[model samples]
Target: MKINHVAGARRLAIPLAIAALTLGACGGSSDGGGDSSDSSSDPSKFSINLDDCNDPDSATAPIKGTFDVGYSAPLSGPVAGAVELATAGYDARIAAENAKGGIDGVKVKVTYKDDAFQPDKAKANGTEFIESQKVDALATFGTGPLSAMVDDQNAACTPMLYPSSSTDAYVDVKQFPWTTTILPLAKNEAKFLVNLIKDRFPDGAKIGIAENQTASGKVQSEAFQAAAKAADLKITEVASDADPVAAATTLKAKGVEVVYHGGVTGTCGAFDTARGRIGYEPKLVLKPSNCVNAVEYVAAGKAADGVELGAFGKDPNAPENKDDAGVKEYLAQMKEAGVPDDVIGNAVAVSGWTQADLLINTLKQAASSDDGLTRLSVMEAAREQDYASPMLINGIKWFSQPDLLTGIDGFRPIKWNAADKRFVPAGDVISIRP
Candidate 1:
């Protein structure tokens, strides 16, 4: 899971000094806002004016000009893997926008700060981006990185979109006015799996869930519990453990029929260990980002065959998904940029492409100021655009359905193959009602 960003981490200290507070100039522009004659080859073709597009409940009109976009990422730290995904997304966006001659002819600049996944650092970074950077809006933000300000974003009226990690705090649409998620929540994902299992594997409808004793595990537990109740399916004991092996041992003793284990692909063998011990097995439905890298997880000898995972988009290497617009471009760029195939599969690029496209839509409707960009204008511009994210192989749409402010509410059922060591589409997308 090495993100490969240590080449020049020494320079981060300088930016760290300049970006001490959350406010400053990062010099960027509104994305995808210029001549239609440029590189249309990129699948994310963003039009200049959004007049033809449908904008439902466009809260206000857009104000364009030197719009500021603030970013808070790991930039340099231990939790660098998560930040690496976020960085890749941010880079793709800035590159795309710069290629388009800048948003609304005014180039977008991002003020990025490094908090290394530390809350105090995150708070300082947020303040630096807002006060010093004077950003009119935000894009590709991390839910886990700056999670504390969930309430602050609502109070400030600063709209934001996520690259990954959709915490429950932001999922409640009513509580947060400015934040939106691009991934399906745990509850939505579990609900989709429950219904899919009922239709696909109805014969043995028992659920055995083993959750990791982590923040992620708790979130997953909430979703699985709710889904089990809704489907009227019986959920076996909820075992909490940091040791996957122990969890497997417990499940084996329970004679579990269906198992939902909460852990990364690198460590899902607990299910197999339990199967070996009990000499019995059941189907599995993991988190959306749970078992993405087939070559990594399956190659490690995990029993991936017939196991289902919830996530957006399909593997780029998968022949069926290669022809797709988003999939093809992401794979190509990742390779050209020297990013490994395994990292590309992280869905970081997809997160960027989705938000970058939406931001272009926002810029087209921005209201320009007499001298520069303003919060009122940016917010208004955001309201004028109709967000239409690219369709993922999974049942989820990158953008919300009816409500423009909502987050990504769709997911796909991916089946893992022990033989091929990859995830294949099990069924259609499960769309969650917001």
Candidate 2:
């Protein structure tokens, strides 16, 4: 695995390329005079013969169709704020692409439904996308919801593009051919986090981990234990629960010098609150997930100030990224979509935006056919590309290989500036090879 600064122009031709793709692959005559057989074979000449509804207000009227992709995520719940921000990224990217004339010639529309982070709801939404919406594909945030709907997705053969889960089981290529997890696995991420801690702190420094009791959290804890053993760092405390403040307090009592949080954004807030209460601040290291809603931690005031976080791309709120082409475009698009600057800065939003970016790029490659693209073709195309998303950190590109299930293997570390409500570069992007 190799990591470098993400440096490149925002890909401008993706929309144009998708629009320019026609039925030329069908061998239709270039000249006005064409063979009857060739003319009949042209897919462009065929009309979409959808039946019309008699009721004017029925809303089932026949109209020109656009490319429909389904997105199911928790819109309202404990993690609602984070989920909304992630969807905002998806919305911003879709608006930008549409303004550029959409994917090829068809405008892309996301049929969104809130799953409320429930597995059953996610499965139901998956069925709707397959049976009713007849979507070309599906995209989601979080691994649990994605895992819940995997069987349905596989049965329907509708590609599940980018689910925001770093769980290894969710990304098993052989088991879930219809699914693709874009981000690095949590285990790999844990290794990177440990490496950063070891490099920054002394070998004998007391380190602590605060995480949820969920499956992903357990995996993260296990990975941390292994990495800690290799790094020769002492793990003084381990906390698992909804509230991370208790864990923080325990670590503080043990005189832990550093703390790494492997839980939700709100848990980060809990840590901040606990630290504020105890008036003890250890060097806090958070994963990118915690940084997604930095403002949440901001409410805890200086407790979370100067916290360092991991990053797979340029920090969305970093002032230094203001001039970056990709950052400029993202900000502009997010603004146009009416997303507030604060929410746009969420790291989760960056995740959703990059996911859509990768899917579109892969679609462009897969849709180069006489009959247009299918879900299968898109999945196949995805496996073929070494994808470089504009939202990724400078110098690193996600490459899908034959033997590897995960596409990303590196990330940079970032620090949160409470005064500016932004994340600035804390260190260079580093690769974590398996």
Candidate 3:
């Protein structure tokens, strides 16, 4: 789990030296804006017209020292508890990177604000981040909040990296090129679930889903319906907040052989508990990737046993992954960063760490590129990344191509072992094509 500081230092230094040599050979400008004949290989290919979006005081110069980032999230609202765990991971990862001398010697400084999960507040936060705070980039949590401020971020021509949600808004490069998220698309998750059902029940089986009521939930529900239709599987839908016992009884009477809960952690827990109380046990129970939090299972108590979920990263607290190098490093870093011992292994915390890791890696790539760490270069690096993230599940690589902008390739199916209070790998990693 220990980092090789000397090797880490060398890794950062070598990239800069090579970039410098490459730039010199190509007769590029020191600011990395020189004209080049090969547009395809040009680092500035993704650079937007700053004049179109810039204000009187917009910062457009290439980063030479400190990398300033602005972050906003729901710090005191309904989702604050989950957001706080993510913040812990983000802060810990930043601390770990700074201890390693930062990305190519440029220390990262993040200014955080509480948007309280309100869209208007999120938009206002983005304005402050770009104008008042004068940060080079912006980051935030939640789909609705990020969606609320994306237009503003694009108008300001600022890079917004590693948002914590998987909404399709972040992947539309033609629309919001300044933003990208590390999370797998919710549609992709739906498709994977459909394929899983097809495999297990080749002859077809009755299915029911406890669906969320939010806008994002509607999108997810649509995806599921589309996938189910394509697979020729019948599925019944129920509102997530419906009386769980009543919902379970109705679905059971209808002979629902499988149940997929498409709500957040709380709803999932309540549904599972109600199903147990009503003595209704479907052949299989499925929860969305976002519900992989330990709190969900704890809330469901023994009812959560045998529940399955799609996960993109390893849970640090899972006994099977206790010896994993990535998990170990995360535990050490969280401990070092002063995260409480009990909260270190929370899946939400791990997700936050993963987001920070993605940003840190993207920053390094930008710094080493001929574009040399401008806001545009950071976005370019994020959109073109093609490497295995050490913090993710083994064998699941991060990739972004001209055609595929979401980056994540797939997810591993993990089953909740309530007896052990941990998630264990239940099946081989499932791949999803965009």
Q: Pick the lDDT winner.
A: 3
350 in model 1: Cα distance from truth in Å?
3.4
Q: Compose the digit string of candidate 1's lDDT tens values, residues 1-434.
A: 00011111110001111112211121112343353232121122211222211221121334345556776656665445545664665566556666677765777666667765565666676666655665555543344554754454445456564534545666433244356555556666777777766776768555788786544556667777888888788887777647555776677677776777765333454455454554555555454454454444454354445666776655666778768876766665556556655667665445554556556555554434331243434433443333444435544444442123335556666777777666777766666645
The C-alpha lDDT values of all candidates are: 0.53, 0.66, 0.73
Q: Model 2: how large is the Cα RMSD against the reference? A: 11.4
Best by TM-score: 3
- Please list the Cα RMSD from the true structure of every candidate, rounded to 1 decimal place: 13.6, 11.4, 7.9
Sequence-dependent TM-score of model 3:
0.85
Model 1 lDDT-worst window of ten = 5-14
273-378 in candidate 3: lDDT tens per residue? 8888888888998877878778868778888898987888877876778789898889889999999976788888888888888889889988877657777667
Candidate 1 Cα deviation (angstroms), residue 50: 26
lDDT for residue 71 in candidate 2, whole number 0-100: 86
Q: What's the C-alpha lDDT at position 25 in model 2?
A: 31
- lDDT score, candidate 2, position 362: 74
Kindly give the stretch of ten consecutive residues in candidate 2 with the minimal lDDT sum: 4-13
Instruction: Measure candidate 1: CA RMSD.
Output: 13.6
Residue 144 CA displacement from its true place in model 3, Å? 1.1
Question: What TM-score does model 2 achieve against the real structure?
Answer: 0.79
Ranked candidates, highest lDDT first = 3, 2, 1
